[model samples]
Target: MSAQLIYDLVPLGSTLVYTDGSPRPPERHRKKLAVWETRNSGGRLIRKQAEARVGNTVLPASITLHKGDYGNQGTIVLRVHQTFSVNSDLKFAVKERPAIGSVLVLARPGDDAELVHLAANRADAEEWLTRHGYPRAVFREITADTVAADAVEGRAAA
Candidate 1:
């Protein structure tokens, strides 16, 4: 699937994988394997930024994926995020979608809201909110209606 399709159809917090259609290189070829991993890895959808005009330049619409987090013990030091423009050439596939009844913890309420976390239930969401400070976070529950709509629209996860 195309990146645009992902931005339009796949809900935030869904797991997605993008690949260059190449076989994985052997571990012995460290450099080549590292490069291959960059082009072929899975991540959770986090943000979708719409196209915007800033002075003389027009920014393209893009989707951001949370690739990984680096930390020690319970402290997170670095977060790896990959943003792909809708025109990206890499092949993308929706690996998994947030299940119905799950709650999406958005950064805020708006078209530009980013998914901060996906909780299994409202109770879990509240527990997470207490630990993570997102004063403006909004909770959105995944429903069967939404899933049905996606299917009706031919946006089934591959």
Candidate 2:
């Protein structure tokens, strides 16, 4: 499924909200200004600057409120500053969903057992495991309905 990627250029003094419904106070280090420049093949140059917030925990500028996985729980909240639209194709690529007939593998450290990487196939996973010096890796086959079931379970848990 595709979704409309709508957002506003967060203003200088606006505060953002966290996913847990808490407000994040603006701070000096949390604010950042970035400048991007690009040159096209036709010799046209373009420059743009954008402001963003950075910290341990940062809130989203906009959100789709009250839309439950099972059904609609309440009315959607469309704030004035958040009301904007962009026409684009959005694909939600979940990591657990590998290509059909491929294998999903998790590379973990030998000493710490921490997940280092998730590879789509056994060959790539083995390569990563060897490169990272991981002792072992876990592999699972991707069936037709495996990804769909996992997605549904994830939504329900959330």
Candidate 3:
């Protein structure tokens, strides 16, 4: 029941240049570049870091975007890395049958349900549901066959 980690890359700004010796577009100067990380709890994602990166060349602590301004065009790419952890253990009673290699989701009463764990076997799934206080009726299981079919579909779509 550990949390999941998510990574995202964002674009902050770009280095600009002027053509025909014109400064019509005011130059926007920035000191340092940064990235932030957040956690998702109860369907709410919160920002946990204010300044994740700064300009650093030797220590390799910050990230820099380098792009050339050609024809009054400038482009820069910023990479943002994030990690999140969620506790997925709950205690409840089991009322449904379990299957191997099935994905299980725990549904809470007024809150969004979350993926708690993957079941290796019927016993394991049943035990997890019973211990996590999740009723079998509130739990949804995606069987291994279905997962394989979904993977095939995903590959085709891609």
Candidate 4:
């Protein structure tokens, strides 16, 4: 699917995998394998930015994925995020979506809000919010109706 489809249909916090449609290189070709790895990997959808204009320049809409986190003993040291424009050449697929009854912890309330976390329930979401400080964060619960609509519309990973 195109990145635009992902931005439009796939819900935030869903697991996504993007590929350049190339076969994996043999391990012996370390350099080639390393390059291939960059073009093929999975991550959690986190943020989406709409098209914006800065002076005379126009920036295309984009989506950000949380690729990985590096840490030790509960301390996060590094976070890797990959942002892809709507016109990205790579193909993308939704690997998983937040299940019904799960709660989405969004950083803010709007189309551009980022998914900060996904909690099991309202109580869990409240507990998590107490621990993390996102003053303007909004919580959205996935409902059965939402799942039904997506399933009927063929929003599942393709």
Candidate 5:
């Protein structure tokens, strides 16, 4: 089985309102960011994008997904930082069965980047990814392979 993740919603950062359009001038910066999640008719997670309330500020695009079924309904939380430049710094990394059971969490500084990650087994991998500010694209690619390998291992262990 491949590595899969179910992520819980986590607030990225704070948003401040700015009246001026100066990216350099911190005074003109607005903290409010646009947060939205895209899902299909089946309620499956699609993608998440966050943009600043003022100016053309856009946060780093990332994917936060939950692999488990939610009472027969599926949902995932998507969020972006309050600043645009901050989005560009997003990245992703994954390691399977770290010290036993599956878990995902952001392995970086700053609690805002930290997210709780749970696999099919309610692992912490998803959480780790959120804390690290990883891009959604990388999450999909790496998790897919990791989960696949995990399945084989799990079956053998069972």
Candidate 6:
């Protein structure tokens, strides 16, 4: 379904939720995380910077939200990579979703080991949602060039 790509952020640890409506945990228990993204004018999803899911109990849990048009359908979403310390249940309420593009799912659900679902290619993405049990996932094409640019910029700054 080239409708919308949902790069849902799946932050690991119980700190994602606190005693109140806090989106982040206290600084002592919090780890730095970032969700960098970019897309073409056609609304194709692109990965600007996605950190590796490393370290003990570290999870890159944030989505790069975007929007796009898919034939007669339209969607809004982003690219997401996540890792969990252990099997845990979580909740996320995105005020918005992707318009349509690439859904490069870079994380694995610790609880559901069989739920590794993500797609490339526009047509394949449409089928991905139907077959892989993904909701509103629309994958577009993202080449290494997209990320190469990011590296160059980083090097130049350094």
TM-scores for every predicted model: 0.93, 0.32, 0.28, 0.91, 0.17, 0.25
lDDT of each: 0.90, 0.31, 0.29, 0.88, 0.29, 0.30
**Predicted candidate 1 versus true structure: per-residue lDDT over 1-158, tens digit per residue:** 88988877778888999998999999999999999999999899999999999999998999999998999998999999999999898999988888999999999999999988899999999999999999999999999876665553655655
Residue 88 deviation, candidate 5, in Å?
23
| lDDT (tens digit, per residue) of candidate 4 on 1-158 | 88988877777878999999999999899999999988899899999899999999999999999999899999889999999999999999988888999999999999889988899998999999999999999998988775555543555435
Q: Which is superior by TM-score, 2 or 6?
A: 2
**Residue-wise lDDT of candidate 3 within 87-106, one digit each (tens)?**
22211111122343453444
- How well does candidate 3 score on lDDT at residue 102? 51
* Stronger candidate by TM-score (1 vs 5): 1
Candidate 6 lDDT tens digits, 13-130 = 1012101222443445423211111111112222323334576655543223223323434442443433321222332232322322434442333322222333444566556556
RMSD of 1: 1.5
Q: Which model scores highest in TM-score?
A: 1
TM-score of 3: 0.28
RMSD of 3: 21.2
With candidate 6 superimposed using the best TM-score fit, by how many Å does residue 83's alpha carbon deviate from the native? 3.5
The runs of at least 3 residues in candidate 5 whose Cα sits more than 4 Å from the true structure, single-residue gaps closed, are 1-38, 41-51, 54-63, 66-104, 114-158
Model 5 lDDT tens row, 1-158: 01111111212111112122222324334333211111111112222333234567544434333323323243334433222232222222231232223333332334233333324333344555545555641222234354345334234311
Positional deviation of residue 42's Cα in model 2 after best superposition, in angstroms:
40
What pairs collide in candidate 1? none
Q: What is the Cα-based lDDT of residue 5 in candidate 4? A: 83
Ten-residue region with minimum lDDT total, candidate 6: 11-20
* Candidate 2 C-alpha error for residue 138, in Å: 2.4
Off by over 4 Å in 6: 1-120, 156-158
